[model samples]
Structures are given as C-alpha cells and as structure tokens.
Target: MCGGEQGCIETVKAALQGGVACIQLRAPGWKKRRLLELANALLALTRPAKVPFLLDDEVDVALACGADGVHVGQRDLPVQTVRDLMGPGALIGLSASNSAQIQQADVAAADYLGVGPVFATQTKTDAAPVLSPEGLATLKALTEKPIVAIGGINHANIGVVAATGVSAAAVVSAICGQPNPLASTQQLAAAWQAGVK
Candidate 1:
C-alpha cells in the first residue's frame, strides 16, 4: 500500500481500473486479522476483473484470502518456506534489491522478482541502496523470471525504468497520492506501455 495511509483502498481500486496487471497489498505493521479483512475486500475487487491480487510479507493472509499471490522480502519469510506453504500455482514474488539477493533466490519457486528501490523511496525507508541500471542488468542477465521494478517510480521517470526490459513496474505514491487516482494511474500505465514499445 502507499505510505499515505489514507484513502489507500480507493487508490488501489483506481489503479486496478486504470489497467495495472496486479496489485500487492503491503501493510507491514497491521494486525493479521485486520490484514485478512482488508485482503477479503481487495480480493473481491480484483477477482471479478481477472487481475491478480498479491499480499506483501504474509503468506497466511494471501492463502486466507485466496489471493493470487504474495510478495516477500528477504527477511520477512524465507521464500522456500512460503512456497511450501502456498504449494503449486501460487505466485510467490521475491524482493531482490541487489545482485546478491537475486543470485540467492530460489528462482524455480518464485513467480517473479521485484528489483528495486530503483531510486531511493519513502514507501519503505529501510529499503536497500538504489540499484543502478548496470546492477539491474547484471541481475536480469542471471535470471529468466520477469522482473518488476519498484521504489520512487512515477510517470516522469518510468521510461527509464521500463527501458530495463523488465515485465512491470510497481508503484505507490504516484497513483495513491493523487486527487484523481484513476487518472494518475492511467497516466503511469500509458507511460509504462509507451516505454515498453
């Protein structure tokens, strides 16, 4: 979720409508029950649209809500453990902020990799150092899974991120902090698509 912490649900709804292929609900500090309840609501919003819904850091909530997947940080939950818990066909996205983390990933068990804080970001203040294009390219060369770049991404700089040839870009404040979230999301999507050629 966006760091704004306010109107995040509406922002998520707007982004889904604006053509984001997936949405990951990331509330790191919330209670498990509260997260589950939110997941239930988000699942309803995503399922009918045929878009995948992902939970950040909690495999239990992902399974409990019957969500499409979950994104886990290196320390949050071991990827193998989450994969085992979720079983087959469950999307398990891993956060790989550096070449080392990417190298350490169990690629066979992961659906995709999140390669970022492309630039520094406020969303997760504790994010690793910004990954330069060369570093990202190095990691990309080592794996086949489509990479999703996140952190400090917005319409203005999305072109640079998309040029890395990864599958998608994960956004937070760009769409969530706007007065018209749908329009903002659409703008970013259009930008991303245009950059992808």
Candidate 2:
C-alpha cells in the first residue's frame, strides 16, 4: 500500500487482507520519526503474513526499522550505494525511466527496478511521462532485472500493464486511496494473474 494519506497503517492492513504480495511504506512530507513508526507497524503486520515490506527512498529508515529493502529513484542515491549500506539479502529497487537508465543501473546490486508512470497519475505530482502498455513493454525488454510498474496503476488497467510482462504493479490510489482497500487489492490481484509473466 502507498502512504502519504491518513490512516495508512489501517489501509495497509486491509490491503494485506486482500493478499497483496508486498507492501511499500511511502509518505511524502512526513518526518522521519513518523515514517519509522509506520514502518515498524507495517513490519509487525508484514512479518506474520510473510509479505516483503519495503521503504521508499529512505535508506536510514529502512536500516533503522530493518525493512526488507529500499526503493530508490534516479535522483536518489545510486543502487550500489544502497546495497553497500544495506548489505547482502536486503533488497534494493532502482527507478529506470528509459533504456539508458536501465543499461546503466547496477543490476547485480539491485533486486528490482521501479519503471514508469505507466498511466497518467495524480498521486505522484511529479511522476514521469506515462508509459502506456507498449511503452512499458519496451522498457521491460531492456533489462533482466525484475520490473515493478509504478505510477497510475490500478485495477482498471493492471491487466494491460501485466500483459506487458512487468514483474509487478505498484499502486497508490488504487488500493491505498480506496475506501475498500481489500476489494481493490483483490481486483488488482485478479488482473495480475492474467499477465503473460
């Protein structure tokens, strides 16, 4: 579940009930202390479920809370740096917006890549250009690293994104912003099952 909204921990619990494969803690504009608290609560939830718990762009938070990993973007620290900080077995996901970015990323250091604002999104005000399904497919072909399609992904279009063979779909408003996060997650999971990969 994506954060930056009220009652995010509750939303995360509901989404977990619907069988989300993983959970990422991301609340923009919040203080580190609050983020750490949220991450700790999520760790409590995710550990029992055996779902990976990831922190977005905060290596310190991830390290402090012992998160499964951290997801970093192009402007953030390099993937290698994060790997060195987290050491082996801790996951690292890097953003790869284009072929060049994909080629340049240290795949051996990163466990996955968060690629694209696959559709137009309002959650991330500064999201990259929409990749559509075709564009997503193009990017997916550029790398062997597991690709998690982020930005604007939701139940309505998750199937199409899945058809592009993205390794996973990351959402914000789709599940986290839903009144019924469990239902949203169930729908998204169903759509994901239809993907070629």
Candidate 3:
C-alpha cells in the first residue's frame, strides 16, 4: 500500500474502494517494530477487501505481518533468499530496471517482476534510469513472468504502460498525494482496463 500525509491505511482503503487490485506498504525508514505495526494494520483492511497487502523490501516485517507478499529491490536480499525465508507459498517480487538485470535475476523463484522507472520520477530518490516505454516493451518481450510497472506511473501514462501487457502498475503520489484518491484510483484503473482491452 502507498503511504501519505493523509495516512497509508486510509490511502489504501480509498484506493481499494476505487478498485485497486493490491496494496504495498512502503515505509523503508521506519523501525522494525513500527513497521510491523503498520503492516498488520494494513493487512486487516486488505484481508477484508480481498486485496493483497505487500511490504516493500523488508522480509522480516512481511513475514511478521503475514503480508501476502514482499517486493524487493535489486540491492536488497536475493529472491531465492526471500523465497527460502518465506517458504514456497508467499508471493515475492523483484525489481529489474534493464535487460541485463532482468536476465540476471532469479526469475524462476519470483512470482513477478517490478519493472520500471517507466518514466522519470522523484518518488524514489535512487530509482534506476527511466525505462521509457520502449525499454518496457523490450523487457516484456523477454519474459513470461508477471510484470508490474512502477515509477512515474500516473493517469497520464498508465495506459501506455498497461499497453505493454504488464500485469499491473504500482503508483504512489498519483493516488496518495491526490486530494481525491478514489477518483484518481478509478481513473487510473479505468485507463489500465482500456489499455489492456
């Protein structure tokens, strides 16, 4: 789930109501105990809504919360390590910015790949180089694993990203920073639906 000044639990709830398929709680700077508290709170809402609750880059917090999954970056623990710690049933996502990284990842152990900076973004200060639409298409052509495009994803470019046949798109400010998250989520979701059709 996305976090915000308005609060992540509320942000996720509004997005879910607007038809978001999943939520990833991403508070990397938080302490483990605090992170666990937030993750559990997120799980409560996601569970009832039938939406998956994922933790960003913290396997321990994810396991402690019994989060449906965990999304890790390239520098984080390896996908196989996470899988071993998570066992075989939990969902595991790994980030890949380019073809080299994609070819190098332990894809067989991952359930999906978080592919992007589809556009330049300030959300993640250290985000990899922008993987323009063409880059995304190239990656898509090279893989059969599910891809969820992230970074600079908003209503403006969501359709283009979805057109690459990505299984999903992860957004932050587009929903969390908006004044009306529900409408924003609905618009993004609709754009994605239209793109896939």
Error of 1 at 188 (Å): 0.5
Candidate 2 whole-model C-alpha lDDT, 0 to 1: 0.85
TM-score of each: 0.93, 0.94, 0.95
Q: How do the residues 72-139 of candidate 1 rate in per-residue lDDT, one tens digit apiece?
A: 88878887888889888788899888767777746558889999888778878888988765667677
**How well does candidate 3 match the true structure in TM-score terms?**
0.95
Model 2 TM-score (2 dp): 0.94
Query: In candidate 1, how many Å is residue 56 off?
Result: 0.7
Between candidates 2 and 3, name the one with more favorable TM-score: 3
| Clash list (residue pairs), candidate 1 | none
Q: Locate the minimum summed-lDDT window of 10 residues in model 3.
A: 1-10
Query: Would you list the clashing residue pairs of candidate 2?
Result: none
Candidate 3 residue spans exceeding 4 A from truth: 1-6
State the displacement of the C-alpha of residue 42, model 1, in Å, after optimal TM-score superposition: 0.7
Over 33-59, each residue of candidate 2 has an lDDT whose tens digit, in order, gives 989988998899899999999998999
